[model samples]
Target chain A: MSENKKSVFNEIIRPALVLTVITLVTALCLALTNAGTKEVIKANAEKELLRSKQEILPAAEAFSEEKEEELNGKTFKYIEGTDASGEIVGYIFQNSTPGYNGPVTALVAIDTEGKIVDVNALDLNETPNVGMLVGERDFLDQFAGHSGEIALTKEKAAENEVQAVTGATISSAAFLNSVNEGLAQYAAVSGNAPEPLSPEEQACPDAAEFSEEKTVEKDGNTYTYKEALGEDGSLIAYIIRTESKGYHAPVIVLTAIDPDGTIQGTATVDLQETPNLGSKIGEEEFMQQFVGKSSEISLGTLSDTSVEAVSNATISSKAFVDAVNQALELFPLVSGGAS
Target chain B: MSTDKAKVKEVFTRGLIRENPIFRLVLGMCSSLAVSTTLIGALGMSVSVLVVLICSNIVISLLRNFIPNTVRIPAYITVIAGFVTIVQMVIKAFFPEIDGLLGIYLPLIVVNCIILGRAEAFANKNGVLISALDGLSMGLGYTIAMISIAFIRELLGSGTLFGVQVIPASIPPIMLFALPAGGFLVLGILMAVCNRIAEHFGQPKAELGCDSCAAYGRCPAKEFEASQDEAQTDADRKIRKAGARAKRNEEDRK
Candidate 1:
């Protein structure tokens, strides 16, 4: 009789019974936890959102949800920032734009005067130092105090344009585009043109004042190339000066382009980079590789090119390439003068 | 009482170093490799595993008597998943940053071999309190291994500790240390160092590969038996060949 009972328990009931019991108990535990945490989670999310809203619009004491619009299946949220006395200070618009690897969402705040108060990059999955450089204070600050239809350029950022992050131009462009979308939405509702760049910050540093130079248009802006005279008073080679943002600081390279469009020499005008790593870019062996290469040498880790980047200093290497490419673009225009 | 104390101590200490889940046992390596990129990520993952492991062990040990051998695996899996779900909900609600960092790996802990292996090999056979103790020790061991690897990766990859800049500005961080390849390289070197240390202590370095692994007891293939059978057959063939050679020699003499 006992064996018969055991067989029944073993054959049919036990497996189903045990699994059912375990699943029910688990479900009970999870339900209890969910009950306790649900409200706290909601509150935490709201609190975080409010805190970020206040952070970009510091002048405003409170904010009101203005309106939201759906474009291309993405929600663009806009809020009206009000002062302590309940006066409208600025409008904060949140938008997400697809970046190099992923979508980067940004908060762009424009005051009543239509000038940008501040721009903050919120949720972003870009690579930490490469694409996420948009989070840097200096990079974000470039957007503040600017107005009008936002444009991103690699050139020295004039009043109307923002400079792209070196080696992360795509991400920078994406970040700028997200902000531009926010501004565009704000304009669509209010029908106000974006304020132009302020006059005080309009003058870009004069590259031509240093020497006799020839200006040529490359991607969008004019870059200057000058002739370097040897001790005998004859033209040695054309010098193209360009700057690249490195891991620590901007690396400026002056490349000498020969008449045949080959690189003659390269010199580091300014490089306050990390020692043993970014400093490798300035090493004789690394810079010498660019000397005989054509001005059009493609620069990347995977690309088949004559120049190889330093082992751990890929950012610095790319920056060096950008500076070299700037010089290359100047080569064809000045090839006649050098010859 | 003294022998009992010794046995308990042995169980606990074995997990801490002798059978570290990540380095010594090489279990739960998928999460370890993915989440050790940052110190906080490692800590969050370790805590999640700890919660699931302890809870599952206690439940399994308590239900050991009624659970039929035929349904043991499924029962253990349900218990583990229950705990894992609880952990996931708690983390998502309270520690959302960690939830984001761990991503799907937090849920994937249900399938981590260590938790189920313990349920089958240790928890089901042990008393509830002892099973819980075993789970805690194993989780701690895994946590320590994760922190050690993460410490190096975070420092070298981002030049930061706990997301703070501790390395001086002069040192350029090696980006490779933050990538997936760095995880594998660091894990390998750490395993080798641990083996060396274990050998130094006269604990024969843990047996290599899955055949001798403790987890293999639960493996459906019964791989350990197959390996044993292969060895026995090889031995039997050698003995038979020896007998044939001896017989040939005797016949020649005759």
Candidate 2:
């Protein structure tokens, strides 16, 4: 009887032990891999934030990240960029409001005089085609010169205020809410009533030329490139733009480059891909691959030499390449001089 | 003697058709429904399930003599989970996008009814070779069913099949067919159509039971079997009562 019981134990207990060992080893490996990749993932996220700032404040000389602060009962992060002389160039303020599908977070740049510089949609989770129209350039461009007192009412308003896009009413309203929140905070910080722009005085024609061509000579190499015009007419120096196609969408990137070719900034201007998978291409490590490459370099070469395509992000990477190629081609046209 | 071997082969072949995991047994509805929205998703899911099922069956059969009856379910689950984890990690490292699409369903395969049911009913009692065959046949059956459904859904819903647009540009595709509700509707109609075909051919309707159904002891086949046993007992009692009545009547006449 004792022998039979021992046999039963050997038969049953032994296989169970083997199975448990196998499971543990497999799980341990997974945990290890995840740990190994976590840092690269985090760096990728920071790169995206920097890139978004550059897109909205094209001419910002350098960005100074401010601690999160609350003004007028709303929370915001005030990022102020300055030129070589330590003068305030522009302010990139992060704000959010409820959009059609979910919260729409945006970064808006305003000059010292309180004129609209540019707006960048940082994160938007809305339905495709219908609510996604909020990210359209024409729609976002409406908030370019807006100030505190000007209401976002769709009428032909003063120079500072403009109409929202049709068929995307909710997205437009969400942007307005974010802008209003930013203005309120600015008022609190300055300890003064916010300035309002008159209808005739609102539009800043000079601001439009910031994205226009400029000639600059550096290290005996004269390059004519479009300088992103900041609110105060400071030249936005370092920029990099990359585009790749994802499995389900196009990936368009715009990044700022420091003189040394280190990534000064990066942002995903467009992405239409699978929700969780291909969308990860927009993450930091993937975009960080383009950090500091010369703007004169073609995006195709950058894509090849930089980060490998996320397995399913091939289509997205291709689209990104195309967008970058267009941005690179446009560089010469915008700058109008030989680099 | 040759006929006997043929009969054995026929029994094995029946699993591929008359007892298919998807069409006949309808064993793995969760994966079939979730990943069938896109052809690539379906293909990825099928490959993962196939690998897990085949590996688990082989391991279970090889160690059948060792598993204690009391802890058999837990032992089988551990084996299945080991294979599943391996598949998940490999996909994550190499095929992250496909990994994302398969998502939670890949891990859920640890509890897939078709796999566990085969392990318990066939692999435990069979030799290693037959058990492997059983796993392969069932997995293939599942793959075929899934791909067929995905082909239809992707083609009609998005005007494309396997990412290639097959339907003309003029035709307005029914987009909802690619959503969750569409998955259920397509699976239901497909199952019903399959059942109708089986009935027309006079084949016994394959039982519809999921892994969860078996765990809860509420499978339709189990219910049917219990009801049949109860009816037989009732008939036996009635027969004895009739016999008693006839005996009493004869005695009275005598």
Candidate number achieving the greatest lDDT relative to the actual structure: 1
* DockQ of predicted model 2: 0.07
Interface root mean square deviation per prediction = 1.8, 4.9
lDDT of 1 by residue, A50-134 (tens): 8888889999999997677655455666899999899999999977878877788889999987788999988777776678778
What is the DockQ score of candidate 1, to 2 decimals? 0.39
Model 1 bad stretches (over 4 Å): A1-9, A70-75, A193-339, B92-101, B205-223, B226-254
lDDT of every model, 2 decimals: 0.81, 0.68
Runs in model 2 with CA error above 4 Å? Answer: A1-339, B1-16, B168-171, B196-202, B205-231, B246-254
Clashing pairs in 1: none
lDDT of 1 at B114: 86
- Cα lDDT tens digits, model 2, A1-339, are 999988876787765776576557656865675676555555655666677777777777678868577665656678887877788877777778989878987777888777778876755656443456578786787777777744655666566565766657788788777877776665655556645432111212232233544445544644343344457766444233434555654465664533333334445654667766667666666666655544543323345344455566566655654555545544533344423
Docking quality category of candidate 1 according to DockQ thresholds: acceptable
lDDT tens digits, residue span B1-254, model 2: 89957756754665665566887776888889878978999999999988888888888898898676666788788788777877776676566668767878999999999889888877787788778877887888788789888988888777787778799958967766776677788887887776666566556544544422212242446777779989999999999999999999999999
lDDT of 1 by residue, B172-251 (tens): 78878887888899999998898777677666545655654434555656776799989999999999999999999999
